[model samples]
Target: MRSTTYYAHGLNIKSELFFPEFPLKQTSEIDVIIRFGITNLFNDSSKNFREIYLSKFIQIKITSCNLLYLFWNDIQIFTIKNNEIIINPNTGLDLNYIKFLLFGYGFAILLYLKGRLVLHANAVDMDNSAVVISGVSGIGKSTLSFAFHQKGYKLLCDDVLSINIGKKFQIVYPSFPRIKLWPDVIKNFEEDPEMVPKIHDKTSKRFYNVSGNFSDIKKQIRAIYFIKVTGDIKIKEINPQKAMMELIKSSYCYKLLNHHEISENLSQCSAIVNKVPVKILEVKKSYESLNKLVEIVENDILKN
Candidate 1:
């Protein structure tokens, strides 16, 4: 297997897949090793798990020992065994599924298992600090980060915010330099959506390469913003209790958490809320209003 060593979320990962777009560095020591191989993941008859989450397209099981089984629609199955992940992809599976598996939710869970506070947020660097922008899907987290990129602010991470929680501070690690954008977002930038390359065939979303628009350095989080798309443009500071609830709600794969994991995750959220400035940002969804919304957020960040 061909392997490449890369740095992401402040960890040295030796992955069998050739993900060269990340900040690559050759190293003899590896913190996490990812391998592409075959396994009978569907045959979990003998294995035991304490918590289970099932849906029409996905099934996730978390063991009492903290082991995880993530199955993606029969296309792929990921079994996290310690620091190593054995990915079993069906024969002749679409390459898009592989990309989605590796980039989308794969590493998020891995980071969670590694004891980092992972959030579904996009982050940008401003004044030597990271400002995290989070919300539900389609709420324009990445689009706003892209707008910040246009203004010369460095994009720290596009999707996942792997946080290093200290006593009085929280630092968000840098991710790979790419942002996924929908057709509407491209149109808002006055760009032809048809010209952009789609990330997957099942969706209209495309990957926007932010190689030059990103920073290689991770930064301490100075603020967090939860965005709402259908309201008048405004920003409001959220209290710690409310921020904790919002953080838990916005977490990726939160439903699969066991009782212990849920408590730990909530504690982490509370810690973050206590230390960082958390706020709710309400902005109207329109091409004409995007710039004004960016300016509003910029002003808030500058003042605080």
Candidate 2:
């Protein structure tokens, strides 16, 4: 099969499998390579691997050679070594499901291995700088990002944020131009949920392609917000000390990090808190208040 080149998170990726989510790029220098192959890490007789993470949907193991194995039941298996990812998919498995796994969890782990600070957050370009919004699952992070996109702000990324921490500044790289939304949220946007493509067969979630309003270049981070559902809309700045802890908790694939990576993560988080403003955004749980929330955040960011 002919290979394709794509760019995301500041890396040039050459892959055998097609990734509809990523923007195509023509580059001779490749930072990562992904190919389809049969993975046998689970059946290896050496047994030098140790299981590091286990969840209902996925399991991870690492070998002494630094090879990471990600298993998604019998449907798909991935072996990540160096800058290469080998994917093994079961026969008759839908390509959409494979793409979902490769782009989400698989790519997050790959970014972590490459020594990038990854956050489980939604990022948007606000006034030439990046602003991040993070919260627990189903807490409207993507919804808020969509609101920003609708208001003429360019979206940087959704779900996984990759950052390059410098001595005095941190830059956030754009990850594709896609946002996942629930069926009801689609309806709130005056769009037919059934008309949109589902993220996976197991869920009613749909993805919106926003390539037209995507910020493809990297941007300096201006602020970070940890949101919660509250009775009213309020935005309070967090101190550096407390903000560091919150950033650590919001890291992507944090549970899978080893001790050394955890220490590095702590140092990186500290740097981020000191350089950018971190705040607590209290928002009501009603979609009707989305505009108000966006206005409040925009004003707050502008004032700083």
Candidate 3:
């Protein structure tokens, strides 16, 4: 059996399946253990049902047994029990599809189960502090993060930003050493989009490896920026009331959780806003605006 240890979002996971995008770590104690195996159908006898997130293609289920089950559009199922994960992909389906889901939503849900606060954002390190950038899908979170990385900031994580809250401060843990970007975004960075490896055969998005620009050290979060597209570029601190709302909105899988789960995360989100500066960054969605956008964030976030 192939096995490896990957460090992601403050967890040291030892998995039977290999995830090349994550940096290898040597640890005797593993926070999570994963294994890829044959599929098992969700038991109808299970009760205390909650649909974490449901789409036409995929749905996540939480049963009375506390098992978190992720069904991938008839192609595969990911079962998480405690710290152990079992991925059961359809025999004939492409493994790449399963792989893509596993790293993205699969890991986010697992981290939530572990009680680690996870955000759907990309973060970069600036002088040992984390600046998190979040927005709705296709708002260029990863692309802007990549731009920060090119400008000498170490990329902390992309897509899923996990934070550890403490009495005095919050720390953002480093995630995988890669970012998923669309073809046009890759082209903006002066790279051939075609040369970038596709995330899955079914999608045109590709992953950019940033091993040299990756940072494993956890940093105290300095600010959180919720980006949006606008005709003109601007950055401003968000009102506390709106910041709380943005925090709730930017959280990973917030819609899928039960009322209790939602309440718990809400408290966490409320507490986080008290410590970190939550701001809105508005900019035009064009390559010509990226440099100026980065400059504005650096001046505001790094200086404050």
Candidate 4:
């Protein structure tokens, strides 16, 4: 019983991290097995991880850092690698820590497992389907995501987008459900000062409980808007490859990593480019820019 198994077209996967480099295959024989490294967040860094290899879609990885926790829908599983950690079965998994990881960005890795290689992008729901705004981190992924949320659009996930690639590709995951806003950004959204979550560190964390109906609905991989918050007030489509290149460069599109990582990145990117239409959406640096961009998506691109 293993959490994941990896078999690549070129390399023999020595570690589970290399498994993702291999495209998805349905087989009974396991080439590489990963007994999910699960550990408690409150637990000491020296603690060991619980090893259980089961087949299902999950998004935790064993990299340079320790494995904290993993989410499968609503269920949360905590772990202690190498060491045994028994949590109260009643308490189940820790939601408080999920909020923290959302801020720190553990969800991006999970998005990879589920199918999409998400960058520090942002997304919001419009006319039922979701619209994703992708660009470099400070280019207003969060700011645009929040602005749309204010204008009655449902926030899906920020920073991570789940993409499914094989033949026909699609972005299947909700928008980054939670948002981490700066102190100044918080004041505009919070009517009551006490409504905010507990503050422990310098970063202010805010969690937006996504709707079950919306989360389950895999939003069609509509146009990927490359966000450039320039002083220019313009919203239109540009060359698709040019738009894709911006996301690839900014997100460290690791297709050039190693053969294994490259293979995986290629497998994912090819599907994305072939399936979804990429566009360049440039606007002046303002919250209202998102709305103007949406007008183009709804009127110009998807409508056509």
Candidate 5:
């Protein structure tokens, strides 16, 4: 099989399978490899693995040898060892869904192993710096980030944001050039939702490719916003102490981290809060307010 190289999240990924979600890059260095293969972790008799996290739809296990196994219901099994991800899929799974999982959760795990802080957020480049918008699921993070994209601001990432914390600066790496949106959000943007590709057969969410509007370069993080649905629009900076807690809560795959990683996460979050401004943004829960929301955020960014 011919392998392809792609760049995202500050890493050169080489994979045998083609991933349209990521941008193709020409590079000799391979930071991560993705391939298809059978995973026998569940059948291993040695049983050296410990279950790290389990939910109704997914189960995560880690072996004593440092291999990570992720089983998503009956759909797929991902075995991550070192810099390689081996995927084993069950019958009748959609390739789009597989790519969705690989690009999101699988890559997130890889970033975690590489000691980067991964957040469940969307980011846009503002004045050559990155601004992150995060919240609980279905909180319009992607929609707002797309609004910024519409305003000529380049999108750094959507759904997953990775950061490298240095002594003097926190740099955020761009993810793939894709954003997921609900059907209504697409209609609000005056595009037919049915024309876009569905993220999965079971969901109405669609994937919007923003290759022309993507920022592939890494940038220093300017600020982080935690948004809420409220009656009015407001933005207020949060103190470092409280910001640290919000960062922890917004961490991707927080329950899967070990004790050492948890300690490191705490230290990194503290560092980020001390160096970067964290704020709470409250906005009305209506699509009509999107333009106003964007105006308020841009003004806030300009003022700070």
Candidate 6:
């Protein structure tokens, strides 16, 4: 059986984020392990599949899906047919619907099971620390994430960040370059036409999907920045308790976990608070302001 180390980092509390699971058990086999989280897991937009699915990934569909919890019936797992699949009730993952969930989906599952992630958000290694930027949607997280990259900080991730907690909150995620910025805001970064994709509106806002030169730079979470979007721009430091709240508010997939397994998400964030410093990055509408904020983070975080 092939195995690997697993990590979990939550938003409000700290917990052991390891769960030993076999890889073959995950694929090409009937044996299965299921987990649960703190949310409904099955969110119904009733807005139809079009609004729910992305414009880039419309090829896959789930017209007839069974959106029920695996734990809706039992306590301990029981054996089904040798070819049948068992489910994790507390997790929002719907194994019956598809072959595998994306990275975000898997991360959410790990958190639900109270498993920590080895990496998270947009982070960079500076003097042996992982400076990380995290926030809710439309909070200029991407603006700040890529800014560090431009300043010679290796870009780690764009949208989602995960942290693995053992000795501390060791951040982890696959190599991803560039950030998704508002179409109108792309010009400030010297918008390279080649990097910008065709502008498309998914939910009334224009999305500029862009790419960067370095796409394989991954690192740990040395610092945490909660980008706060408002009518103006500013930067400040918050206490650990407040930092934990912001972490929860900016949690990657907390609400998406309908199965009520939120212990892990909380645990990951707690680990960060206990070990790393979490800060607040307030930004205004102007990209110049964003630049100033970036400079502050780089000067303070990257240098120290």
Stretches of candidate 2 off by over 4 Å are 42-46, 74-76
Steric overlap count per candidate? 0, 0, 1, 19, 0, 49
lDDT per residue as tens, model 3, 168-241? 89889888788898998888878898887899899999988888988888999998999988778999777889
User: Residue by residue across 1-304, what tens digits does model 4's lDDT show?
Assistant: 2234333311122232222212344556643233334444446464554422222533332323434354444344433222221222333435454334433344344334333565656666776666777886677777666666665677766665655554655654554235545544556554443465542343454443334223334566666778776677556666656755665664432421335755677656656776776776777776545577556656755564
Residues 1-304, model 1: lDDT tens digits:
8888988778788888677557887889888888877766336554666544444776666665566777766554777764877776553656666667667677888888877788889999988999899998778899888888877889899887788778878878898888888888888788888987788788889887778878778799988999987569899876778898889887875776667878888888888887888999998877677788779988998898
Tell how far residue 104 is off in model 5, in angstroms.
Answer: 1.6
Cα displacement (angstroms), candidate 3, residue 215, comes to: 0.9
Give the per-residue lDDT digits (tens) of candidate 6, residues 1-304. 2232222122211112222211111233222223232322235333232112212332212112322222222221211111122233434334322212322343343343344443235565455456677766566666676666666655555555655666744655433333456545556667654455432322223224323433343356667777777655556879888988877776654543333336766676787788777887777767677668877776766454
Better of 3 and 6 by lDDT: 3
> For each candidate, what is the lDDT?
0.79, 0.87, 0.83, 0.50, 0.86, 0.47
Q: Each model's TM-score, in the order given?
A: 0.92, 0.95, 0.94, 0.60, 0.95, 0.57
- By TM-score, how accurate is candidate 1? 0.92
Collision pairs in model 3: 52-256
Which candidate has the highest lDDT of all?
2
Worst 10 residues of 3 by lDDT: 39-48
Model 5 steric clash pairs: none
- Report how far off residue 152 is in candidate 3 (Å): 1.4
Tell me the lDDT of candidate 5.
0.86
RMSD of every prediction: 2.1, 1.7, 1.8, 11.2, 1.6, 11.4
lDDT tens per residue, model 2, 1-304: 6799999988999999988889999989999999888878757655797775546768888876778888777444788875999888553667787778777788888898888898889899998999999988778999999989988999999998988889988999999998999989889988888998898897788989999999999999998999888878989877788898789888877888778878999988988887889999999998899999999999999898
